[model samples]
Target: MPENPTSQPVPFRGGGFNPRPRALIGLAVMVVLIAVWETGCRTGIIHPLVLPAPSEAATAFMELVDSGLLWTHLGASLSRLVIGWTAGTILGITVGFAIGLFSLARAGMVPLVAAIFPIPKIALLPLFIIWFGIGEGSKVATILFGTFFPTVVATYGGVDNVDRGLIRMGQSFGLSWVSIVRKIILPGALPAILPGFRISAAIAIVLLVAAEMIGAEFGVGAYILMAGSLMAMDQLIAGVAILSTIGLTVSWIIGRAEKALLRWRV
Candidate 1:
């Protein structure tokens, strides 16, 4: 591996924009921010009424754990999130594929989706409550409705963006339409669809919190609402932290899925 000054080879420039992990950097940033926040609160530079210290939030979080309400709230939220997100994603993908592959579906549904996608899904919570009642049904329906439209847009967009040349080559080679779609189109579309999952998951979480705040009893959103009503800023922050943890967990799960399913790119 000696460097030859007289006969130098060209440097390799084919390496794409590969991302490397910087976990420690992110951790350090969070630690520093918390330290500053705690210091400010202790020194009276930051008012407790305005922003609670990180330690106060931690104490509230531990209190929930000690009372065993943490599990109850987390379990309820996770159940709704899973059921709603799974159902919406499956349905969106099915309809998306149809729209992407067919002229009639594309013509009819695209306009409908465009019209509905812009409306804030949270605004329809009252209607859902009226239809499904102020129960688990309403909450799940809220999350499902919020998640469905974005997923449809992302999925169909992904399919549309797939290379037509590859599809034509498949056809010229006498490959079946099903085979072309399964092999070439599906994989090509995954890069977009997976990120769509991320968007839908975030929407689902937001909708879950909004819906639960209405009439739900055993959820992180309900906990946050109660804490806010009682002026318990620390507990409110703790609830927010719990939501952040859920977001992080969902993101990690999606990253793992991408790693497993998109190995061809590696």
Candidate 2:
């Protein structure tokens, strides 16, 4: 049979929505913005007192480095961030797995998570201080609490969303319960869980700042608070830049983790 003359092969339209990595584009955008900001400050389009130049912020950052206080402030924040975020992540994963794997745990914990999740964690800082005192304990507790709920949500949500077909297939193969959970469920849930980690990390930083601003003496938040109180915009911006750097660093770490752990997807 002859093919119809008007019939043309359909153009391929199955391009996957995979993102291409053009990291330079992002870097260029940031550079352009900073250039504009610096030019504005130089030309008086923006006031110095209102917003210090990026150069000024850099100078202040250098001052911190020279004075050796950068490490002091940074070390304190890192310790808290690491401790609190790690603790929260561990517990969240545990609780989330519990909720996902067992019916009784789900019935008991889901409502509890829902009820407590909506409350502002920053608001609880005062209560934490009252309970744990105006020290590292309160600050750590604030970050921990802030991180925990979202992680729990992410963990259980990931688990629930895992393909039951895969689970059934494993069972049909006579895989043990622990083996199924370890090999199938854990990997399936990681995509969700890792991003949840990103969210929890961001929350932990915010809570850390808030917690530090109240009573701590040596953290990025404390540094920013002091700079603001003294009307030192450069130093304030420097402190903020520090926090941003920390966030970027955390994001990069997580990205590396995703690449390492999710190689099977590719």
Residue pairs of candidate 1 with colliding backbone atoms: none
Question: Residue 71 in model 2: shift from native, Å?
Answer: 0.1
lDDT by residue (1-266, candidate 2, tens digit) is 27666767889999889999886999999999999999999999999998999999999999999999999999999999999999999999999999999999999999999999999998888899999999899999988898999999999999999999999999999999999999999999999999999999999999889889998889999999999999999999999999999999999999999999988885
Candidate 1, residue 25: Cα displacement in angstroms equals 1.1
**Candidate 1 lDDT, 1-266, residue by residue in tens:** 46765776888889878989876998899899999999999999999999999999999999999999999999999999999999999889888888899999999999999999989988998999999999999999888888889889989999999999999999999999899989988888998899999999999999999988999999999999999999999999999999999999999999999889878885
- Give the runs in model 1 whose Cα sits over 4 Å from its true position: 1-21
> Over 4 Å off in model 2, which ranges?
1-19
What's model 1's TM-score?
Answer: 0.90
Best by TM-score: 2
Candidate 1: residue 195 Cα off by (Å): 0.8
